[model samples]
Target chain A: MSYMISKATSVNKALDEAVPLCEPVLKIREAMRYTLLSGGKRVRPMLCLAACELVGGQDSTAMPAACAVEMIHASSLIQDDLPCMDDDSFRRGKPTNHKVFGEDIAVLTADALIALAVKKLVTSTYFGVSPERVLRAVLEMAKAVGTEGLVAGQAADLAGEPMSLEEDKAGLEHLEFIHIHKTAALLEAAAVIGAIIGGGSDEEIERLRRYARCIGLVFQVVDDVLDVTKSSEELGKTAGKDLIAGKLTNPRVMGVEKRGNIFKGLIQTRWFR
Target chain B: MSYMISKATSVNKALDEAVPLCEPVLKIREAMRYTLLSGGKRVRPMLCLAACELVGGQDSTAMPAACAVEMIHASSLIQDDLPCMDDDSFRRGKPTNHKVFGEDIAVLTADALIALAVKKLVTSTYFGVSPERVLRAVLEMAKAVGTEGLVAGQAADLAGEPMSLEEDKAGLEHLEFIHIHKTAALLEAAAVIGAIIGGGSDEEIERLRRYARCIGLVFQVVDDVLDVTKSSEELGKTAGKDLIAGKLTNPRVMGVEKRGNIFKGLIQTRWFR
Candidate 1:
């Protein structure tokens, strides 16, 4: 299997382990699988695992952080696919979480998934890391998901949802902030958090931050490219949805040449394992 | 000032002390204050203060958790008010976060605020409780916010966003979960977290939980009644909005006789300080 597939499968396994027992509610089980098992690439969770293993740790210890990162990512997607957020019909070659599950269950499922991830962090880290470190991680992750990070980006993204050319076209900074925060912050958190849990030094952690930043930008560029280059049949997510949504993407920023240059420069630096 | 007011003010003061040196992004700050200072009843944070005091502790150490509860609460509100979610145009007599800050900034601001609150929990708890306890507090708060708690409720709520009478009809059970998880769970966390920070015994913590549950339910009940009796001109939040939104409420559940009974029973209880 390709590294991505293996990593994604293991991350899915790790996520299964990390997900708390759903309250045996029909709604929860249905909604959760709708989003989780819909088969998107588990890129964020893989980042956590790769970072953990890079520093000589395993998913056994890093699983909670991994799950937390993915949960935040997944929750964002569930919301993103909502008729209000992204409103795209398909994700990972399947109907979006809200579309399949209905909106009420969709929102609740995302909320529950986020809760499960955080709870796991508390439980797993309790015996593994120093209380202070664990506390720090929880706080850090929370902040990562907070208003300034993904949520803020999401709000901004949603604000720009309708996509009038006159407005969003000029708001490139706004769109970048949204992308960086909404999508990349959680990805970065997975890596940084994995390093933290794996006992990487502060300097190592800083390097990992740079690593995550590099990959985050690269990952997003790849996404922008994929969204444009791929067909809806080629990419699970709707092709060119960003353009349709009027998202201020790098491609949208500098067009084909400039965006390609940035993507190439960053991707060559080896963010991927 | 009422006890709630004094407690809220004090927590606000400590929040100033405990928060990181905010460089102050204008959009972010505007979004934060637009809701935080918008004259909330502060019942949740007040529960934290009362719990801290009740456990013979001071507000100095409980500040972060107090602020965190409020931040968490605020983030949820922003999410809850999304066009795909509750779809409310106004909350507390003001335009909802998305309506005012515009969706993008409002969402980002709510997110940033939540992250800041987590940061507070990490740093703030050092003054009183152990780091482990602070982590524990954060874990609890996360659980409340996510699926099993508020987020799940929200998902269910959103699922019902385009409700038909044939569906759950905002059933009493569903609404109970919504209100409890969305409101009471956090309130309970604020209470227990304050006590834990104060070094309360397990017995005291249990007592606080019971107290929290009672007051939380009472608070929700009062809110339900207020939706009927109070005018939006005075209450800020529009009256009958719950029904308009198809919420499963106490009035809808218990009818007049049972509603009055529940309220009376709560008022006579010793849960309130």
Candidate 2:
């Protein structure tokens, strides 16, 4: 628990320095800082930092990337809450970015964060990591965010109802697709980038990649369960949105008990052993 | 003219290949393909290629980055035409992206293009450019797209009435600020990246950077004039949008004739000489 706290603390500090409020464009910067520095669990950054340290890389070498993953996450959250997208009013117990910053600024904020995220990773070379690894990590991060990753998942999620009604094998595949691309891909990329930057061998990187993928799926499944079981106040965002919107989720398609068992089974089978 | 045709031809072919409209997320892919393949003048790619060749870099080496500049440009256009932004119905004589794809997909299209642009530059190593150079080019592109560039420009452009009211020196400064960041930065980055990829010396890269900056500003100023002088049929977009939106353009700040002379003077003094 202390280790996690230390990692989150450093990640927050790095994020603050990365996106200073004092800027040539103060309003947009405020919007960016509002969303980015808003406290989440910092799970993605912790994964990135842990993977780097596990592979013998110094924290400084990976700190920029850890911050970058969080930036991407923030960008995604802002976009997801936009009126045209998920249309949620709140996130992390506060008004969504679009609600606070207005729609235009909110849209630009997401874009700026994405550009800043890529810039953060590319400039990470100053820490003495090889340019080749940095380039690879950039490619990985891009793929995780682009069509093959989050974009695809979000699109699928938005094209709800038709697919959600199918409780067959195809529905399971669709659900898995959404979870993997929308949630797991960034998590997987975070760990993979950390390992690559930390001088891990190809074998080690692949192992970490697999581990992170499972964890990402597990994370989404748990989130799905929480959306079903918790209230809006408890969850810090609008809960039961998935059910109300008729969006597909593990609990919805496979039953809450079954989904919980699957989550438990994966955890015990993969991590404990 | 033939040289321009050749460069644009190769760029078109490369762009088609880079964004293949295949399965998985067919809708998003279609939206991406629609905007990306839609005909533009291809000026940015031409400048990127010209800069590369001038620095003795092969076309093959810089084609990916050249395509990347266009992708970023396309992303900006999509976002610029959003209902909350410019709110234009027509772009390049066709319906804007959001008009065709709906707002949700349109937003995702811009995002996917950005990630793809970064991906394209990062994977340019296959053309044998050093990873160091690739990393540098990526950083340049990111900066051009982020707060210091397009995002900043658009933000200022949106806060229109207040800045537009200041037709004094400060207003001119504001207009220049918007033009440089919104328009010129990407062009400068394009030329700079080309020079870097083509293995130009720092001095050569800096020279191209300056040249591209001037050209980019001239492009916007001319565009502003055309908005006033031409009809929608001639300009291929909603003509007089700047006037209608009260957008701070060159013609709005300075008389059309004065802006025209400035454009003519720049051409005669810079390129012709």
Candidate 3:
């Protein structure tokens, strides 16, 4: 836990410097920072660094790849928070991008951030990384966010919530699937792509992938727990909004108390062992 | 022109085949195919193929890049047809994807098509092309679609309208800029990236870039002309939607009568030269 905390703080500092450089358009960049700079666990970048080290991929290239993951992750969240989408007003314990900058600019900020990620990744002076690897990373990132990944999950989550509840497994089942694609897909990409960028061997990539899948599921499980356990002060966003909105999260479907045991059991599986 | 047509028809047919195979989800794949088969001039893909040929590239890689460009173009058109965006019911003289598939599924289709583009590009089994080159293609596509390219233009366009005619320049000044960024950026990417994949020299890539830029701009100029002078049967989609929206476009700003002279001049400068 201490190690995680220390790593996150270092990442937070890196992000502080990185986000400023992403100011392609001054107005939109301000809106991006408004939401992006808000404190969070910084899990995505941490996963990148962790995966990099696991495969012996320590270098400056890691920062660009790590930052790229964070940028993509940040962009998706901003888009998801749009009024036309989830209509979220806050996230990560602060006002969402749209809430702070209005819908037009907020959405644009998401766009800018995603572009900045690719732009930075491609242009980085990482030797022998090849335009092919960079392109693969870009494509992977796009796939992670596109229909089959995060956005698809959002669509499913939105469509499923109207019909699911305690008495029905169908809604919860859909929501769980949504969570897997939406949040977990990118998290998985963060680790696997990091491993690839860091030039990890194929076996190491797979190990990191398995490890990432475990953590991605855990992160969502934690999110589910926090949605019920955390308050507005703790979450920065509205507390219990997911529950109020009739989401089929783990806590909602499995019951808040049951969630802890399930999370623990899953992480303790043989793979993690 | 006849050669271009033959080239386009063959390219279109290949894209039509490749698109469905890449669809990760069945329904989303069908949704994507529905709009893609609807057809435009296949301008983006043609540019891609043209660049590959210009660079004297091999067939093993060029074919997939051609398909990828069309997919990106198809995805953009679907997004533009959304009720929350352009709100158009017709495209290619037929009902838009949202009208046929419904908005919920329509959004997903666009999302799926975009992802499939990445998948197809990365999954290519070609040589002399590294993963690095493929990754660069992804970044270019993302940069084209993400905030700095198309999205910013779309946002500007959305914000530009609803102002007084006096604000027309401000409103439409950005319209062309948007179309260029949103539309032409990817077209240029299609050309430039295709050359890169083909193993073209840097000089060859630059030459192709110049040619592609001219064509891309001309393509938009012709589109502006078609939206006015042509009928629904001729141009497909709504012929006068551009005029109806009071959006700044070639016919609207330059006057329908003067477009011939202006287009001629534009061609002479950007193309004929």
Candidate 4:
């Protein structure tokens, strides 16, 4: 926990310095900062930093990629909360971005953050990372968020809500698709980017990619379990949201006990490895 | 016109090949292709290609940058037409993206296109351009659309609408702020990216930047003029939208004749030079 906190603090500081309220678009900047600064676990950045350190890279070398993943995460959350999408009013115990800034500014805020995330990676001159590596990292991050990544996952999740329980169970393939693309792809990219920035060999990068993918799936399974067992207060979002929304989740498909076992098995396997 | 048509044809082919309807996200890809492949002037890409040629670079080398600017332009237009933004029903004599795809899918389409635009530049391997140049182009393009660029211009444009005419006129600096950031910045970036990809020297890139800035301003000023003077049929968007929306425009501040003279002077100066 302390290790994660220290990394989160560093990521937060870098993020704070990254986006400032300035002229012409102070409101959108404020909107971006509002959601970004709102506290979360900063799991993506932590994973990125961890991957960099695991590969024998300097922490400073991976900071920009770490920040970039967090920004992408924040942008996705903002978009997901919009009236046209998930329509959630609260996130992390605060009013969602669209609720505070109105949908127009919220949309702009997401757009700006997405662009800024890419720019941050490309313009990180202070780190002296190779341009080729940075370019690869940017590509990884981009692929993670585009139609083939989070967007597709979210879209599939939304499209699946109206399915009957039997259909959903039969649609396990589709469920895995959403889980892999929506959640795991970005997390995998986060680790891969850190490895690239840290100058990992291709073999090491591929290994970390697979490791992060497993961790990401475990993360989602745990999230589904928590949704059933925890309250909104504990989760910092509406608990049982997947169930309420009729969204397909691992627990919904495999039953809670089996899901918990799967989660535990994933962690134990990774731990022993 | 023939020169522009040839450039547009090549750009269209490249853009069409750039985005394909693949698995898991065909809907969003269709939404993106709908807006992107929809016929427009392709002015930004033309400028990019022209600047590349002027710098003595191969057209093939600058193709990716050219397609990127058009993608960025398409994204801004999609976002601008959303219900919360310009609320337009039509663009270029066709239904706006949201009008066809629904707001949720439209938003995702815009987000995906923006990410893909950056990815296109980063992953352009055929040209053998330096990673440093591509990275610089990506940064330049990203900056052109973020808080300091299009989003800023858009936010200011929306905020200025409710102001009294006198207040808006008093805010001419603010109006220019919108024009420069919203319009000129992307155009400037387009030329800069072209020059960068084409391997122009610092002086040449700077000159192209200045040239594109002038062209962008003239473009917006002409747009405002056409909004009032031309019919909707002629303009392809609602005529007098600026007046109806109370949007601050060059004609709104300086009067149509003076704005026309400014546009003429801008073009004439560039032509003579």
What DockQ do you compute for every candidate structure? 0.50, 0.89, 0.42, 0.81
Top DockQ hit: 2
Model 4 RMSD in angstroms: 2.6
How do all models score by TM-score? 0.85, 0.96, 0.87, 0.95
Candidate 1 C-alpha lDDT tens digits along B1-273: 676667877766755554334643456666776777666767777788778888898877777778878877877887777765667787888888988876546545655665676677777656857876777677777767765566665555454443444444446557666666666777788888888877788899888987787777777887887887778877776678776766667766665457878667666755544
**What ranking of all candidate models by DockQ puts the best one first?**
2, 4, 1, 3
Quote the true-contact fraction of every model: 0.75, 0.89, 0.49, 0.83
Candidates 2 and 3 compared by lDDT, better number:
2
Please, what is the whole-model Cα lDDT of each candidate in the order they appear?
Answer: 0.71, 0.89, 0.72, 0.86
For candidate 3, the per-residue lDDT at B136 reads 60
Query: Who wins the TM-score comparison?
Result: 2
Rank candidates by lDDT, best first. Answer: 2, 4, 3, 1
**Between the candidate structures 1 and 4, which one is better when assessed by DockQ?**
4
| Model 1 DockQ, alpha carbons vs. true complex | 0.50
lDDT tens digits, residue span B117-212, model 4: 988887555688898888888889989999878998999888985455567446677877788888999999999999999989999999898888
The order of the candidates by TM-score, greatest first, is 2, 4, 3, 1
Per-residue lDDT tens digits of candidate 3, residues B228-268?
Answer: 87888877777788688866676666667776776576567
- For model 2, how does the per-residue alpha-carbon lDDT over B1-273 read when each residue is reduced to its tens digit? 998888889999999999887667999989998999999989888888889999999999999999999999999999999998999999999999999999999999999999999989876799999999999999999999999899999999898674443455676778878988999999898999989999999999889988898888888888889999999998889999888777788777776878867677667754323
Higher-TM-score candidate of 2 and 3: 2
lDDT of each residue in A1-273, candidate 4, tens digit only? 888888999999999988976554778889989988899989999889998998899988888889889999999999998999888888999889999999999999998888889888776556888888888898898889887688888888777754655764476678777877889989999999989998899999999998888878877778878989899888787788888887888777767878756666666764225
Sliding window of 10 residues with minimal summed lDDT for model 4 chain B? B264-273
Q: Which stretches of candidate 2 lie over 4 Å from their true place?
A: A162-166, A264-273, B162-166, B264-273
